[model samples]
Target: MTTSTTDSSTPAPGAAASTDERIAVVNPATGLQIGSAPVFDAAAVAELAARGRAAQPGWEAMGFDGRALVLRRMQQWMSDHADELLEILQAETGRVFEDSVLELAYPLTALGHWARNAEKYLRPQKAAASSPFVLSRRLRSYYRPYGLVGIIAPWNFPITIGFGDSIPALAAGNAVILKPSEITPLSIEVIRRGLEECGMPEGVFQIATGAGATGAAVVDVVDMVMFTGSTATGRKVGAQAAQRLIPASLELGGKDPMIVLADANLERAANLAVFGATVNSGQVCLSTERFYVEEAVYDEFVSRVVAKVSALRQGVPVAPGSVDVGAIITADQLEVIDAQVRDAVAKGARVLVGGQPVRGVTGRFYEPTVLVDVDHTMACMTDETFGPLLPIMKVADADEAVRLANDTRYGLAATIVTRDRARGAELAGRIDAGTVSVNDMLTHCFALGLPMGGVKTSGIGTRHGAAGIRKFCATKAVLVAPSFPNADIHFYPANEKVSPLLLAAVTGLYGTASRVARATPRALATARRLRRELGR
Candidate 1:
């Protein structure tokens, strides 16, 4: 990882340019260098942010409809280039070709949704005045863009998180400077070109590739920051934004739980458990990490899960039909997974299926693992094992399941598997997570109208839905008063005549007595006298 500050000779990004320092983009599955990008330092990050700031005004001039048009064109471009994009996704992130489909589909859906609904969601909204005195004035709140927005996306689902976030920010009329994870920078470059091909203004969308330092530099310059990663990094980003008094939306880590009740469909629950825990090699933040099955059905459910786990195929993940699990992103991640599993075994947890890293495989690959008898004391149960490690524990009842599920600091998402859909939904409500699914695994995150985010350490703000676009904007209160010949009663210096009338008015409106009771003889007389004196 090489780093260089921006200078006069710094060529435009995405073009082949050799500098003193560059970051190599290696294929995680092959351990081969496929590409390289200039490692931008603080000065380069600042320069890109400055460019975005300068371009924001013209982009904002496009307004909601005009911006929506650009986003739709981007969606079309994505469709046109789908094959090439999917190939690049597999090359970099090592996700199975089927899972990589979402990298394009999700952003396209979000683009279409935001383009069609932005005006409705962001249009000035009328708000009622709290007091009678202001009833005659019209009150409305307008949502305006935050000028230049800085986005730091993760490698797990680069296109979706990167451009999914940018679509709404752009639709809301703000210029963006995105820094994709170094591991998956190429995918985002393709997205940038799509935006530019669709006639987005120069500098309106930018990508800076590097490591953590690059992201921190972006935060230092931009008006607002949107980050998706781990909780520890999210805290640092939040603190940096706080120091600058600029708001940052963080989508962080999760130890998502799946509650399997006695009434659950045994086969269906087992299938869901395997898919939920093993998808993307368990790299997803909302992936199910812990399973709490009712004691009565524990043995059967565990056996079914172990069977599914054993049947899963681990490979390079390039082929659509042959692979179910892909390579881990890095060797460091594999070591972390191994350490957690070792800790769990030492602490009395038993591996029911695959437990160790895959040997004689190309690149960083790990077996889809299933562990039984895992307890809270084990590291794999308590900490975020961001690999394909499924830990199952038995609970006496639903109450115990809920208690154990809520024990973790992360609350990004959870799932409830039961025969009674109503009961599943009710139990979902009881879980302390941002998104909850009933009789499902990850379906709750795909809808465009629903908000997605986490509570506690999971994240600070929401993404998607109307709230998604609004997150990139700030609300401004607008008040318009009707023209009148008479001045406002409370505007002038205190006068003997108006003082008593104003006192009586306050007493009549806000006093403890009923309106009729407050309208006593003295109050009525005072009102009449004021009306006459004021010529109302």
Candidate 2:
């Protein structure tokens, strides 16, 4: 694929030359030329910002209903055009068509749900007034939009992560400026313009096509930012957002773990383990980066997993009803995966199964590789390879599995394949992650009810559940006085007695609730005796 040339030379559509048209766009799956996504220069960026600023007012005025209607219909259109979306996604990112839909479809589906329920969710709720004397008063809390939001999205699962990250901000009434990766820009436009056609006002959903520089500009200017990418870039975005104190929700990186318990259904776990580690060519934030298997079942599990990995269909992911294990998004990413695999081998790690790419001239395809004897010290074990590379290690039991799982600086998501639901939940609780799946890998994301985010280096804040849907708006507290004399209790000299009395009353209740519940036997007996004596 060759990049289509477009004029991004003029800034503001009227200024002198700004960005010289740059770079060709190559289709990842087939290496064919697709149309170009313009790389905006400073002038074009100014225009985009200006348009976004202009659109914000009309969009905000749409209130909740109008915006919801548009999003609701947009969700329908997305469902209807699911095939087209899958095709575009596969072409642009080398993700298998089925996995592509799995990633994109659900997040887009969330649009309708968010639109329908966001009004209630985003609206302010009543908070305690605290002072009982002013019980007649009313207080409520609500959120406000963060104006413009900057989104820097990655190429892997481009549509899913991209839309999932931005939709909440839009629902919250913030104008969004999206920066899709240089590698997968076309699909983003498909997304950007889709919202446009859904009748979302211009500027409200402004799309600026560019690479890192354009992305940096958004960080320099917008109200808040949501980013999904490598840990390195996430750190940079975090730093930039912090420098401006512009509050960012970062889905940085993950070395997510998947555990197979001794009690786990070895068949199911093996099947999922192979599919989970290699889905999207393992270029997934939540993919199983590390596998911990109980010693009793370790050998059998490893054997079955290797056999399944060897069975994955590695090829061009676009043919009809193709058996698909997706390709890595780029040659550079291919190199990264290759180096990690080669290094691991050199450093005494054994490749239990496939290591090199299969016979193909298509996209960046790598055979599903399984590695054993991997320790935490190796970069392959610690960092995200974002390819179909699974490193397995043996553990004595589930306890050790849990320890090894939590042993990373990153904890975006984890999956455990065990038949014991209660044990899975218990283990999940002990695990430090935003989302955990029992008996499957990456399936939890399909659950709209589940919130998606991470702990440690995974990310800050959340998305996908109620917390995510509500993060788009500004929460504000409103208080109204009872218009009575006691409402002015804080006026000080107006009521010295009342202030202390009220303070004591509130403090005493709080103290009694928290401190007196487990009072010493002596104290309880004394109180009982005193109560009896007083009654007499």
Candidate 3:
């Protein structure tokens, strides 16, 4: 909504803000104006979309190997200029060095992974015919890129979510238009420069930097949209994409739960709880927002978590090792965090560590907090507290834990900690979340081979694995009939003789008891063989 910038201000060189209207970029860590990005209205987004469309054919013509060459070089560019990138990221997002380091690391792996794996993942497949009628025909499917894609990235983890997602889209042979969050648009300018230095074709990848309006414009213009943000915003984007008949892949909010069993390693679980919930100032969608601990070890787990949280240093992140927790990205978000904590306290939740914003700080920072005696009625337990807050609840058993974990509308991810990993995994299956980690937390996001996304209100579609790259593509099925008769029996005229033959064939293949009787023994034998092999 704040769309105007000072006339005296100069735009960042090579920034995509071609228009006079600009969105001022502020350093959440310092509470200062760092830079500004152009406010691209609907017309500007359309123009950029057209440029991307023009460049797409050339990029697509380059083929997978050619794109990989550019992407690999970009990876090298990131390594060479890591400090500059990280500084920009830290300034804009207010993430601590360690958290920012992880943010940068993701894109490095993503660039290489998508570059190397895109072709293999999207390669044409020879699909087997499902019916006897099509047995003579060769059925194959191939993926083709959408000409242009728009990525609406969130303010948190701008580099990882902003550019990381674009890697697969670009590798899939689509030109990408990235609309980074207005809160942290500066870092993306640096990334855009790196891509150019890496010899990526001009206009093949462009940044449309502005606020929500710009993001909406991008959704309106591009062939497909991939959005990562809050669930409420995701729903709007999804609706817009639906209206245009474009596919939308949204990775939205999460109130991810962590369940610690009675037999769990309290030390490891506590360590992860502190790290998972406090990292990125607990702004991650995958952050463990609430905990459902088995009653037997609840006291010990809470004590350990409180100790670790109390030790965290919250302040402005000026440099590496300066603080364990950095400032919240905006005052609005800080207020949200404060309100949630206060609401929890009002509802009889006791804050064991921190319950208020850090005092005497120029920038917004909330102390790493641990809450116990929390329940489903509390905001901290129900709503997404995307801040440095962890609320732990004692559940009678794993069944109750699973029930409480699945009770929320969010189903992004959940974690289970137990010495018996088999039982942990069994409990994980019962938790209704897209990703369930046994004896671990947040590490599943790094397993690029596995698809990650959410269900229910959290998100639709996924990122990573085959789906990540393929979602940028449109699949085509090709069927070839080889050595076909001049006039097939099933072809034109309603032949009475052909009808009976077809009926007999269908009945014999599917409906007949004789067919089932003949196949039963073999099926049983195969099942027995599988069981024996699995036992071995």
Candidate 4:
């Protein structure tokens, strides 16, 4: 990875000078060049992978305790340098200060969580045999590291998703090569430097900074791959990993829905809907994109949502509280947001608040938008609109709300809002998503003990909890028999007497009630035959 530096002559954001082998980094809010990173080719990535492979053994040999120490130090380092890290995050992604703070805070929690729990989660476990025939045998299982792991992170939450995912892979004793999205790659470099300062061994954790080809190279060289991106890109990554026969875990696209029942607190439901849909400029995979509210309260809910969205402060994030919402991460994303809003309007949806890009702003930004009269026929309701656009549809009842919620191909997450907790939870269970939050939204992702992942086109496999760390490992099962006869009855003498005894013993152990009592005598006779065969 090249060191970040500002150059006035460098091309604007999104313009990579491939001939010069560099990707120009830009501050999305200002649309100005912030720095440039080397566009590493396949050969460079292979060399980095080789170095990581060589260092992995030593890192793994350090044991969980040693690794945890380094991780703990990193936590302190992050705390000490939170402001500096937050700055890089803000500059590259153009997210609000509060959103950037989340990107910083998540890794701190993840570092501590994975450091403290990895050994316990990956520890060997004794297995019990189900059959009486294997009672004398001991069975155990343990995990082994995959040696090297590749993580391809999207641009939205560079630190939270990129470094956060690496924590568990590192804890599981694997070397990590993170290929952060070129759009927002600067923040990860800061993390790599912090890890080195915290006594992380060289080559154990490295960043491969470049575009899609760079990510592909990392996937080609690593033992396993974890990807966070669009469903289209995830499919390619999944296919590549499959061709290599390596394990792949994907966190893909989502068109998360919010269901508001008639019994819901209208104020609270509307507040959550606006925040969940517009936070981080609505770039989150788990963000609520579409809403289904009970028709009885639909007009009131839409009114409240529009009021809140209109009150939002959209601007460049200069500091904490500088803006309630920040610039869109890329120009391309701005277009997507505009296109979706237009498509919804064309399909007879009414824009209750914002409906287009903010004017008089040099930075790429979309207005925090709210739409009513939306249905499954509109792209904004059915497709992934990863921007600050919320389109709500009226449902006749909870059943209709559920039907609309499950209407999407993406099943990453969904939210239910109701005053009756039990009813909300029941409806949550019926929603087809990997995670369903009742009376809440987007908070389940922070609970490190709970697993998070998408289902269907949203993603495959999971992150967090035991599945997170264990996915970076290979399981080994060990079975031992402490005692055995010199020539076991089943082992090779081809004895007719031994076969008859074995059959009788099996009959006594598992036969029906009618024959069980009578088979005991036959079992006793078999025991005598076994003793004679053993020369006892």
Task: Estimate the TM-score of every prediction.
Answer: 0.93, 0.88, 0.92, 0.93
Tens-place lDDT per residue, model 2, 464-490, is 667776665556778787555753545
Off by over 4 Å in 2: 1-18, 132-134, 358-362, 490-536
- For residues 413-473, could you state the per-residue lDDT of candidate 4 as single tens digits? 9999999999988888898999999988888878889899988899999888899899999
Candidate 2 lDDT trough over 10 residues, lowest sum: 7-16
Residue-level lDDT of model 1, residues 1-536, one tens digit each, is 11111122123553324336877777787777667667888887777877788889999998887888898898899999998788878878777888888667788888899899999999999986666467568899999999999999998888889888888899899999888887778778878877889989988998888899989998999888999998899999999999999999999998999999999999999999998888889998878999999999999999899888999988876467878888898777899899999999998888888889988866898888888878998988878888999999999999999999999988999999899998888888889999999888787657878999999899998988888889899989999999994777777777887776677765655565566265757766655554454345
> Model 3 clash pairs?
none
Give the winner by lDDT: 2 or 4: 4
lDDT of 2: 0.76
User: What overall lDDT goes with each candidate model?
Assistant: 0.84, 0.76, 0.85, 0.86
Native-referenced Cα lDDT, model 4? 0.86
Residues 68-154 of candidate 3 have per-residue lDDT tens digits of 999999999999999878877787787788888898889999988988899999999997666655656878899999889999999
lDDT-based ranking = 4, 3, 1, 2
lDDT of 3 at 400: 93
Query: Model 3, 281: alpha-carbon shift in Å?
Result: 0.8
Relative to the unseen true structure, what is the C-alpha lDDT of residue 259 in candidate 1, on a scale of 0 to 100? 94
- On lDDT, the stronger of 1 and 3 is 3
